[model samples]
Target: MTKHRIYTTSFASVYPHYIAKAEKKGRTKAEVDQIIRWLTGYNQMELEAQLKKQTDFETFFAQAPQPNPSRASIKGVICGVRVEEIKEPTMREIRYLDKLIDELAKGRAMEKILRE
Candidate 1:
């Protein structure tokens, strides 16, 4: 049998706090990596390459939401109401994101998401 290399332990130990922080905010690994790279002053391309080559579940974490005092307008009524565009949720078309996450967590192949 061939020997398998374990590359995640060092990263795991150092990144646990980041991962926990990210998960608490309900963000995906990719999104969290982006935010962290931005905050740490790393180039985006470098971060992307490293993320795919050397990363674990805990490496990605969501950034906490900023405490903005300004309010954005929300259209339509609060209860049993029809809105013009449905605003927030419809904006990103993220319905597929959940399915993707589930598949990844189940150890499904990630070649598809990488293509996009």
Candidate 2:
């Protein structure tokens, strides 16, 4: 079966949209960065390096230093599909991120959004 096009898409390409969505809702880029750091455990420098490298989604998630255990708590629909119901590992990770961004855009508190 053909892989999803997003698998090969550079994470950097989509990151701006995540920031834009959050910023449009009166959120800050740092908040978006916090969400990414929380989910993937990437420090600021490491996250910047990944963005500079233009890493694809597959490799970006594959190389995550320590994906948070709390990410499994992320649940909701994104693009009409339930995030928890996504069976493919990579796709699920992507949707987990999408759901978090969705929550941020909806003005969810950072504490609750991180499931802390």
Candidate 3:
């Protein structure tokens, strides 16, 4: 089978879509950044640098400062797949981000969304 393109996709390309998804639901870019930082440990400056560098999702996640332990508490379905059930580690990380974004777009409070 052919490999999925998501793994190789540039985070820069998807960043705008994520921002738009949250903003459409009355969320702000800062909230989206917060969610990302909570998951990947990237501060605002680091995230901007990654975006400017056009980092791919694979590299972005691979080089993350630190994956939050609380992320394991994020239980939910994203694109019909249970985030906790995803077998591939990389895919699971991606889905965790997706689930968080979905929660943010659905108006979930930041504390709850961060699994705090």
Candidate 4:
């Protein structure tokens, strides 16, 4: 099977969709950024820099600060696939972000979404 395009997709291109999804459900951009930071360790300035550069998803995660260990505890279906069951490392990382965003859009409490 051919590889998916999302791995090479620019994070900048995808960022807006995530924001829109969350905002449509009453979540703020700041809240979206907060969960992203909790997952990737990027501060506001760093996230801005990445978006400004149009970094690809691979590079975005590669250069991210060490992910919170607790992220492994995130579990559930995203796009109809169970995130924890994903075997591909990159896809799993992508789904982790997807799951977090899903939680935010679903109005999950921040502390719980962050796995605190």
Candidate 5:
């Protein structure tokens, strides 16, 4: 089976778009970074390293230091698809991120966004 193109897409190429989406909605890059950190357990430094390396989405998720167990709680639609209902693991993780960013762009409180 052919792998999805996103699996090989460089994260760095998409990171700016994520930042832009949030910023256009009055959110900050720090908040986006925080969301990424919370989801993938990459500290600020490690996250920066991954961005610098321009890692692919598949590798980025696969090498995550500690993917948040709470991520299963991220239930919502992203790109018209339900994140919680996704059957593929990596795709689910990616959508979890998309949903979180959408919430952020919608101005959800950080505490609740983090599910803290």
Candidate 6:
């Protein structure tokens, strides 16, 4: 399957329409995406049709099944992180790492963290 890259600017442009569709169908954006992927295989028009037909969250999220940990682990590794490390990694951990990387790029605070 092809990975869909949702850019901030593009998402912002269509944000209202997506929100309106979600609200009209009483589904979350994630639910809408899942339903679309299942019903239409990424065809925008078919996705719209599925969204229009959906009347509730349960129907939209019918694809929800707890993923097998091994499958999830394999997918996570494909994106460049170990399964255990990512399982509970917080927004703070991510942001802090980003910040640290930025600081290192500008030549600050590298020795302290590297020596730990």
Which structure among the candidates has the greatest lDDT? 2
In order of TM-score, best first, we have: 2, 5, 3, 4, 1, 6
Q: Report the candidate with higher lDDT, 1 versus 6.
A: 1
- Tens-place lDDT digits, model 1, residues 5-94: 322233334344445554665645665454344333445665555455555322332211321111122123322443334444322112
Tens digits of per-residue lDDT for model 5, 7-93: 999999999999999999999999999999999999999999999999999999999999999998988789999899999999999
Clashing pairs in 6: none
lDDT for position 23 in model 1: 60
Q: What is the lDDT of residue 88 in candidate 4?
A: 86
Pairs that collide, model 5: none
Cα lDDT of model 4 by residue, 16-68, tens digit: 99999999999999998998888888888999999999999988988988677
Clashes of each: 2, 0, 0, 0, 0, 0
Lowest summed-lDDT stretch of 10 residues in model 2? 70-79
Model 3 agreement with the true structure over 14-98: per-residue lDDT tens digits: 9999999999999999999999999999988999999999999989999999899989998978899899998888899999999
Model 6, range 9-67, lDDT digits (tens) per residue? 23233434544555564545554344334322435554455446542333322322332
Q: What lDDT would each prediction earn against the true structure?
A: 0.36, 0.96, 0.93, 0.91, 0.95, 0.35
Better of 1 and 5 by TM-score: 5
TM-score of each: 0.26, 0.98, 0.96, 0.95, 0.98, 0.22
Error of 2 at 20 (Å): 0.7
Ranking by lDDT: 2, 5, 3, 4, 1, 6
Provide the RMSD of all predictions against the true structure, rounded to 1 decimal: 15.9, 0.5, 1.0, 1.2, 0.6, 16.2
The alpha-carbon deviation from the true structure for residue 104 of candidate 1, after best TM-score superposition, in angstroms, is 22
* Candidate 1: clashing residue pairs, number: 2
Compose the digit string of candidate 2's lDDT tens values, residues 75-111. 8889999999999999999999999999999999999
**Model 3 CA deviation exceeding 4 Å by range:** none
Candidate 3's TM-score reads 0.96
